[model samples]
Target: MLQATLRFAQTAYASTKRLFSNLFFEDALGVETNRPVALKDLGLAHSDRVDYDPSPWLALRRILPRNEVGPDDVFADFGCGKGRVLVQAAGYPFRRLIGIELSPELHAVAGANLDRSLPPARRADVELVNKDVLDYAIPDDITVAYFYNPFAGAIFANVIDRLAASVRSRPRALRIIYVNPVEEAAVLAAGAKLTREVRGLRPGKNWSLRKSIRMYTLAPPPC
Candidate 1:
């Protein structure tokens, strides 16, 4: 009983920290983006597609440190719903920040959020693309790709294939940050080599909530 209480306390404390750290971003980060929609609801034929669930605000903070990013790098977020991650990443000094979303509804919300959340300084560097992530042509300059388990099975496979093709054509170093790596096996099959996989939450000693969220870094083989 005592162990369970301590674990609960740790989880609560960590959540509070996540909320406090995300305050610089304009939206209310503490609240979940509980908007729900299935693939069939979106008119997608894929039976394996997962529902929309925004990564917690603290996810970025925990994931970013594993890699060394700078102003020279261009970052793109796949399945960027509501543009929360895009806005948060813009606070960094990346060369450019892009978000690609398939759902017109979510894309519109993301656009509005970006308009309201991003300061004037980041406006020029940000681009919100309202299109299927698979259809969107990745820019050659884009070096980092962020994923929040946007899709799985076929859709996920196609995106990884495109990433591999992009690296083959451009011959540039690429970094992929995948949160909640459900399609990690597909990533490896597509020729990406896993660099790291780390938990997105802090673990409590006793009986903390099982954090299903994981941050992963994978890169295509060098050309």
Candidate 2:
């Protein structure tokens, strides 16, 4: 009984700490991205699609180190709801940032957030597109892609295939940052090599799989 009570207390403390940390970042950046919205609420009641949840700030910082990013690299977020990742990517020296959101409502919110948060100089390089991922062609210049379990099954496979094709055509290094990688097999099937995995830890340092993020690199086609 004592052990169970201690565990519960630890979990509660961790949750509260996370909430305050997220609020602090949002306030510091002057952006509102902590809200979670359901797909059905946005009229996207699809079995394969998940709801809109902003990626944790810590996860992004851990996955995309500043030293790894270059001026020539272009970053794209596949299900960039509310532009949280795009806003974070703007802090890097990437040549451009693209956000692809399927829901028009969320897309509009993301655009507004970017307009308000990003500096004038960096605003021009950010682009937000409201279209299905499968229909939209992955830009050849996109060197980094971010996904947060946007969709599964055939949709996920098709998107990975498109990423692979883009690499084949342009022959450039492509890095995929997949958060909550439920359909990771599809990425491996497209010949991507797992570079690293970042796991989230709760209070007491217990790992949580649900908050894990996986990084994969797709090599350019050989000459």
**Would you estimate the TM-scores of all the predictions?**
0.76, 0.91
Q: Model 2: runs farther than 4 Å from truth?
A: 1-14, 203-207
* Candidate 1 vs. true structure, TM-score: 0.76
Question: In candidate 1, what are the lDDT values of residues 1-223, reduced to their tens digit?
Answer: 9778777877798677556645643335332243556656767635655566676665676667624788788989898877778877887779889998888877887877776766777777889898877678878777888888888888888888888788777776677878767788887776666766556345563222233444334454543
Candidate 2: give the clashing pairs. Answer: none
Error (Å) of candidate 1 at residue 216 is 5.4
Candidate 1: segments with Cα more than 4 A from true spot: 1-45, 200-223
Candidate lDDT values, in order: 0.71, 0.87
**What is the lDDT, from 0 to 100, of the residue 123 in candidate 2?**
85
Model 2: per-residue Cα lDDT over 163-192, one tens digit each: 899888888889999998989999998999
